[model samples]
Target: MAKITFHGAAGTVTGSKYLIEAGQAKVLVDCGLFQGMKQLRLLNWKQLPFAASSVDAVVLTHAHIDHIGFLPRFVRDGFRRKVVCTPATKELAKLLLLDSAKNQKRDAAYLNRKHLTKHSPALPLYDVKDARRALHRLKAVARGEWHELSDPIWVRFHDAGHLLGSNMIEMEIRDRDPPLRLLFSGDVGRYDAPLYFDPSPPPPCDYLICESTYGDRDHPDEDVLEILAEKVNQAYARGGVMLFAAFAVGRSQQLIYLLQVLMHEGRIPKIPIFLDSPMAVDATRIFRTFSKDHDLSEGELAPPNSVLDGPNVELVREHNRSKQLNNVKGPAVIISSSGMMTGGRILFHLKRRLPDPKNTILLGGYMAAGTRGRDLQRGRPTIRIHGWDVPVRAAIDSVSGLSGHAGRSELLRWLKDLPKPKKTFITHGEPDSAESFAAALRDQYQFETVIPQLGESFELGE
Candidate 1:
């Protein structure tokens, strides 16, 4: 009988891995890292319940760290099969994984230098070499093509529109009497989000595993682009830099596009903008390469790109160049990564800019628990960085309706379009959020719904 297991992201918002076993083969989906709360972060060091080397193959739904961050460790532990993903996913995952490894190395060095722990010197979970080796295994597959992972199991990718190459995956385990069909929603993106096409319609399925990141709440009713323009104008008035803590991959690019749109409409004054994170710079290039994957009209993303290459956009990829941003006279905008301020160029930017009252720190996207972004969102008095507390004297703001994840109504709407599923598993959310979403699904449909626990298993072929 075919079976599936939830190894991670069962009751949490990050560390998403799902295992499927059928016809004498094992497949893992979304080998991700655990972020946020200390307990979850510690899991990155724990041994997997199953040997990584035993898995036959892995199919990734997207390139976000929370979705593909653990590939290096998995490769180091002996996973050798092809890492199947869309061509764009393959490109972006390499950039993100390499950056993650560098951050890991830097973090370990900083921890060791401080003698912060009672145990031996800190060590990175995976290094750049590991990341490179993992990238070597990535096998690019085009969207909408069914790739055979095992003799009887086949998988296909449909655009999720959360990012350039994000996908909603469908798998058919042919060993079952009726060829049991299973669907995995990989962080469904917002409907009609700019720079991304709307998520594709959900296909028919016997069972569905879906994300519930924003389950109980809805975004405030407001025009997001107008709000963004107003925030930029506020930052301009300060005559100091506006620091944005953004994820290098999706959020950073979204902000860039939106800023360009505002500029074209003459909503905000022309101000120099710097994309200061190396990863964000690389991701921008990758995004440009995948123009066909987005919803841009013909010639819309043509040469001299109007979106990213607006009048005064700068790409800072070097350490020295990034440092120069601190010295640059402001009334400008600087977007840096390690979104949530976990670690990266954003820290340096924050340290230099957070002490001034004239600077505005715009927190973009969802800030996971235990992250500096979350603290900022809660309006904390001070932000701790590198073992020092920086008083939060700067203006703090967030632009709602910019999140990449789908909202409650959107998720329900996605489900509403499909035929009733035999079973539904709600995941990729906090316990409360997942449970709340599951209850709502039950109220709206007759499908048997559940909020699976970590390592929980279910037999799909009965």
Candidate 2:
């Protein structure tokens, strides 16, 4: 029998870790960081649910901090096993984890200096050394190849299309006496997302685990390109800078692609665009390395001096260059990372740009509750950043349809593509979203579905 447990991201949007045990060999999937509320955030420093040394291996879905953030902690806690993922994920994870470590150190130092943290000394969850140790355990794998885990189980990865190296995992297990197959839809990507190919539909399986981040709601079907063009035009008209808090991995690349297309079509004025995050700039290079993973045609790949290379576009790779952006006069566009405004260069941009009534803060993805981005989205008049309360007079706008995750309709459609599984477990969302998705599956798909609570475990096969 194979036992599966939901440790994190079972009833919440962050902290995405899952434990799977097949006899003596135990595999952990996606050891992500806990984010948002203080209660949940504290979990990051708490003891892991299970003994890290006992875990034989870890299977990663992608490089997003929410999905891969806690790896360094795992290593620090004694997880000596291989952390397996696609080559692209490995490259991207390195950049992201390093940036995460740097940010943690910076935040901790700031908190201590300002006496803003409740903790006495103000410590980072994990240090750069821990992150580097975790990198030592990383093992790269290719898509479509089945890798044997044990006598009873084998695993394969399919292109998830969520990001450059994202994947949906399939595990075929021998049922002691009868065979069974299990599939884990790590984080499904949108079908029409720019720069990426569509998510692959896996073959039939006996049991399935899927994400429901947007399961309860449908994203507006508006054209993001058109909306972005209008927003840019307005920002330009106001003669103020446009600050975009974009997730570096997928969202930043998608926005750049859309901006390129709009610029090519002459839909928006040719204004200077600055990509300020060094991590984001590195991620863009990684994306270019895996162009075959995207849906772009050969022609799209070879465009001369394209948006990425446009004369007006500047790639800010140095800290000094990024800081210089704060001093530049407005009507230009700036895209930076730490999408939720939780941390990163975006905070510096916001601190400088948010007080200007003529400027705009463009939110390019989902913002969890309690995050600074969410506050801005709700029209909060003032926000605290880097230990200082700053007035929020700038225009806050969101381009929602650009999300990487599929919405309610798209998820159901993807579900329908699969042959009916004997059991389906809905997870990786807030409680309301998971429950809502479970209800929909029961009502629309007529499938047996369960929303597993944290620490809940179930044995598959009889």
Model 2 off-target regions past 4 Å? 175-178, 297-307
Give per-residue CA lDDT, model 1, range 353-386, as digits (tens).
9999999999867789999999999999999998
Those runs of model 1 whose alpha carbons end farther than 4 Å from true positions after fitting are 296-305
The all-Cα superposition gives candidate 1 an RMSD in Å to the true structure of 1.7
Error of 2 at 450 (Å): 1.0
TM-score of each: 0.97, 0.96
Candidate 2 differs from the real structure by a C-alpha RMSD in angstroms, to one decimal, of 1.7
Tell me the TM-score of model 2. 0.96
Q: What is the clash tally of candidate 2?
A: 1
Best lDDT among the predictions, by candidate number = 1
